[model samples]
Target: MATSKFLFGLLLLLILVEMNIIEQPWMPGVEAIDCSGKCNYRCSKSGRPKMCIRACNTCCKRCQCVPSGTSGNKDECTCYANMKTHNGRPKCP
Candidate 1:
């Protein structure tokens, strides 16, 4: 009986450890996207660098950059970087 109880306790401990590993959560945050096309065009025509800056800021807040030359459309921006969770907190890199 004692041996059976010991085995059961060990099994329970193993199960708890597994649960902790599986229950790890993912965190989300702002991601940056490429606004090169829009930025260049607007900056050229309007003579306003601020427009590009604002668009970049907005893109950074909403999306993440993928690999360059992978963008499907000229209008579709790519992410330059990602803001993600590290150690239960959001970090931008």
Candidate 2:
């Protein structure tokens, strides 16, 4: 009886370990995409570098990436590029 209990405990432990080794379940757009060092746009020329940085950071946080420059690299992330204003203008700065 003691041997049987020990074997059962070992089997349970192995099952738990196996579960941990499995891949995380599918989660869409749940993880933060890092966009470090990618906000180097011409925001300074816009006379509102601070505002540009804030807008860039906001978009980067959502898309996990940034475009190449200030004007038109929206191809990097469709979600970021497609983000629009109430009047249908691009919202990212």
Question: Which candidate should be chosen as best, given TM-score against the real structure?
Answer: 2
lDDT tens digits, residues 44-83, model 2? 4567777777777777777666776766768877878887
Off by over 4 Å in 1: 1-46, 66-93
- lDDT value, residue 15 of candidate 2: 82
Q: Give the residue spans of candidate 2 off by over 4 A.
A: 1-36, 40-44
lDDT of 1: 0.45
Candidate 1 lDDT over residue span 6-91, tens digit each: 99998887787566643323323432235565344434443456654554445544554322232234234333333334464322
Top lDDT hit: 2
lDDT per model vs. reference: 0.45, 0.69
